[model samples]
Target: MSKKSKSFFSHFTIAHKITMMYGGIFSLSLLIISFFVLVNVTVIEQNNIKAEMKKTVENIDDYIKNGGELSQETLEALLENKYIEVNVVDVKNHKVYKNSVGKLPSFVRQIQSQPPHGFLDEERNNRSEELEKKGFKVDIAKEFNMDDKAYFISSRDGKEFVLLEKEINFEESCYLVQAFKMLQKNDYYFRSFGLRLFLIDILGIFLSFLIGRYISRKMLKPVEEIQQTAERISIEDLSQRIDTSGPDDEMKELAETFNSMISRLENSFQKQNQFISDASHELRTPISVIQGYANLINRWGKSDPTVLEESIQSILAETEHMSQLIKKLLFLAKSDQNRIPVQKEQFCLNELVKEVVKEMEITTETKRNIIIKEQKTVEIYADSSMIKQLLWIHCENALKYTKQNDSITFHIYEQCEYGCVDVQDNGAGMNEEDVTRIFDRFYRADKSRNKEIPGTGLGLSIAKWIAESNDGKISVESELEKGTIFHNAFPLKKKKNQKYS
Candidate 1:
């Protein structure tokens, strides 16, 4: 057989095997039963014939035993029963004692005309002869073919023998022969029964296969959805989620895992991109300053000592900027590795904001002029150092983007259960687009123009982490000329137990 056909048969399913077994058993049982019934019907017909023959023998035997010759009354009764003929002969006198004759059928006449011999015994003798050739003397009389019909013989007075002969139609043999012939007449009848069963079995198997395939597809539908979901995902489209609508099965769990992996991957990618952008921007600034100062020194140092000294100062300044940028980069890398230890505690947010503003005034360019607009005390539960870092980023960002002499404002207050802080800048305000992406690491609104500023894009990203790490959120609102407002909210701090020291 071809490979495909071989494979199909080899992989035949449980249902196919079941159907074949059922049909095979049913067909086999039917064949066996039909054979037994045919044999039984033939035997019954043979017994009926034998019984009639025996009844005739009894009538003839009674008449002879009564010390009377074959009487006219007995002979008349035998003749009246149609399809029968009888003759009794006296062997000593060689004369016919009694004869009752009727117009017998040809077949019956043929049976009687045959030489007087035991019909069943003679057939058994023939069968014994056949068996003897095969080296076995089988008890042939008990055989089904031999016992189906019978004949008998008797002697009168042991010497003056009277031979009485009677025969019946071979009804069983004739009926069986006719039946066998009829069964052979139409090949389609017998063959079609089995053929139709086979066809039905095949159809049942095919339908079951279709149902199994459909169920398999339904069971695996979630896997298919996961595949399509995975296919749809790219770095830009990682935010997409699986469309789950069924019971929470393993497939749903798989979909959930897939979505989680995408989310994590997207976050990592964003952080990496942010790191690269910040590093490039931060490194470029100092390099540019160093180059400009070096060029200036080369051109004018020898001509003027004051110019040479000023160049040295400028170089020192650029070197300091580079060092600070490197330190921030290192800090960010450590944080990415989760190496930054958190010291959690209940701390005053108002005090933290005040400290941040004081530091900014001391260190930044648009410094002491910035006003603190906070009116109320705010406190929260968080890591103190991390929250301070968050405050520094917001303040520094506000200071950097604002023009010289523009005032910065800080407002601290309570909103519902949250401690809210707002830092407003009155300098170069941002647009909606800038507000949306300002927190991305290393992202600057004026990419080309901000090259002079030694700012790493990671500042706001770090600030965002600090806020979220403590179950808080940061937001921004801005208009092009009206300036920008950076908002931060922290959960309320729980009361700490006072320890007696």
Candidate 2:
């Protein structure tokens, strides 16, 4: 049969859904964690740079504290390790001194030239002209703060440079000292680091997706097998089962459950086919007999009264047998459908058994040596009517199988939590095979459906339903040519007003 279309999401198989969910959630989580980690790492790197700049500031301070003067040589000495520029101002003469020789890194702070008058008149014309030729002192620094200990200065491109300036008393004149830490290398490090991080994140997402898909497929393989097995199974075949040889996990449990369902389907199908075949065979006999008699009467009964009477009697008996068979079938049908109602009450088994035994003795045509050897007044909770019928099924079977002198005994007593009854018979008993099949529908110990047996072969089946429906247990013990014992047990303790329908 064609399947109906489902929603878009429903069209996805379980494996696909699992893969998508696992991969999507984990990938998103990885991205978020990577973002925070990147930010954290950047902050720590910047902080370390700031700390190194402070160390450079202290080095410059120590240089001034000693006898080192802020000249061209002083600035050159500080720039020996690179990434730092220096400046000095002879404020009393309105002249500044700075390092020279090569172009400064563009990422470092640039010395913006101010009005030339920031320098002395003689310094610009005489000292500035001579120093400009030698590239030692010039009026290019635009600002200064003698009180500023350490500070950061930013360029137009969002890059930072650390700077510090202080005043020194030298030759009875105040000299301004300044320092700048270049950060071009740090900028390069950040750009390269960010690129690597982005690439690694992408790779991680790809690998995670592949792993999720593989694991989902492996885990959901059993579910796929179950679906295939079900599709292959039809009314004609239910023997296919999922492989359950694996670790005891949820997947294993699901496989076991699927196999169990298949087994039950096979059993039910077998029972249904057997029931139809047996019912037809049982009915065909009586039907053929009735037809034969009717033919006998139809051709000759107008003049022969004997044949007419025989036909009518045989027809009525067959009809009655069919009716009895129908009633038993209906009982089983109702019981199987769980339509039979239960009304429970506490009752004494001894009194009920005594009454049943007495009734059987009085009504039965066959006289067995019947007696109740032990009758302990054990109270049990169950449906009394069903129990009565259950008792009668055993008693009637005993009467049917035994001779006039064989003994049939009834016993009732308490055993732990159960109230028990035993209907034991000394009769023409059966073998293990017959005993095993005695409770099956339309099953006779004789197996041949003997006419002399006088039974519809439904008594034991009805007896089993009665015992189970009334919340009791029933079992039979028999030996070939020895005897049979039918044991029934019911719970002595059931909640008041417990009902089963």
Candidate 3:
């Protein structure tokens, strides 16, 4: 046999625990049902045989009792083919008197110990003793109950008794008796039958397990496909999508969600790469100009104050711009890695907003007014340091983009869903297209705007990252030259003892 077939057979050869559990229950039930059937059949056949024999015995009794004329010649003449033997007894002589082909069984004569009205057994010794003691005659047949020997008894003249024994034999009687004995001998066959039932139950259980495993494997096909699709995705190949057409189950939903996440990740990665490439190219020209102008001053204007002042101021501005760009790039890199682990603590929202507004006033030359239209003493969980950085980006962006004397409003309070912070300005507002990609890295509204501001274009991107990391959102409403509204919304944190009104 093949190895698989041999292994399968080996499993059946050893007893299985489940097989024993279920098989034992089913086998016992089967044995009980079989036993009932066997017992019912045995009882019915025995009853029928006894009923027919009793009928025949009753007929002989009626004939002998009515006439008191029982002779072997008369009995022989009356019963031409009947299976019977008749005997006449002389009570006074203590001997048999009528024609009889067979002698009486000794067991039938030993009847002294029995109640006179009931049947009794008298074997040879007991019969001889009884005959010597009582001077009365008696006769009987050897067997009772079984069909082999049965008889009819009646009295003649109140003293002499007549015994007519029948030899009850038919072709079917022998077969019936043999069958009954076989049934009695092998009465424990049900145990073997229970064993066979156990084997069948074991086979059924094994089949069910095998079929269940096959169905499970077929059902998991979609999941296996999704795993393979995920494995194939890499930095270079982030565009692969899983087939989600099998069924609308959890696996299908997972595949769809995975595809959506991959699309977002691919777009984000592409934007990052474009920003790095553009930033590198844009910085080279200004750096080269600063270096060239410095070398010119060192060669020809060693002691000229005007030349020295001009070169120094120009070099300082270039250095500052470069420093700002480098800082923006580093911040973007940190956000990309999700390295900013937040430190949660309770803090006052109103106080923090005042601190930011006060700090922004010190560094700017523009007459940008800082107005706090709304203030509330709300406490919330946040990383104070990161939140301050996030506030700085928004405040600085509003200040930088607005023209001189543009009033900027900083609203710090609570809304229905979040702790609201709205930074609105009346300056160069963005168009629809620009607002969409404004929070993207190195994305500027116009090339002329970027040149005037000398920005790295990552201010809004870093601000947006901080907001999202803290489970908040940043949005804008703007129109060209009219104004821009930068809304910073943070989800409110529940206080220990304070309840919502």
Reference-based lDDT, each prediction: 0.62, 0.74, 0.63
Model 1 error, position 393 (Å): 2.4
Best by lDDT: 2
In model 2, the worst 10-residue window by lDDT is 137-146
Residue lDDT tens for model 2, 396-479: 788888889899998888887889999998888888899889898998877453558667788899988887877789999998
Pairwise TM-score winner, candidates 1 and 3: 3
lDDT of 3 by residue, 304-399 (tens): 878878888888888888888888887777777776576656677777888998888887877886788776766556667777888898787788
Q: Which of the predicted structures, 2 or 3, would earn the higher TM-score when compared with the native?
A: 2
On lDDT, the stronger of 1 and 3 is: 3
When sorted by TM-score, best at the front, the candidate numbers are 2, 3, 1
Error of 3 at 138 (Å): 26
lDDT of 1 by residue, 1-501 (tens): 999988877787644555555555655665565556544644554454444444555555454455435444555564423333444433222334333343321112122333343543454335434433544323322222322322221112121111223322232221100000001212454456556656665665566556655655677678778878888888777777787677888878888888788889988988788777768876887799789888888998878889889989989988987787787788878878888776667788888888888887778754435777666777777788888988888887777777787778888888877788888887677777878898876678766656666576767878887887776889988887678888988877643462310
Q: Predictions ranked by lDDT, top down?
A: 2, 3, 1
Winner by lDDT between candidate 3 and candidate 2: 2
lDDT of 3 at 303: 79
Residues forming the 10-long window of minimal summed lDDT in candidate 1 = 174-183
The TM-scores of all predictions, comma-separated, are: 0.47, 0.71, 0.54
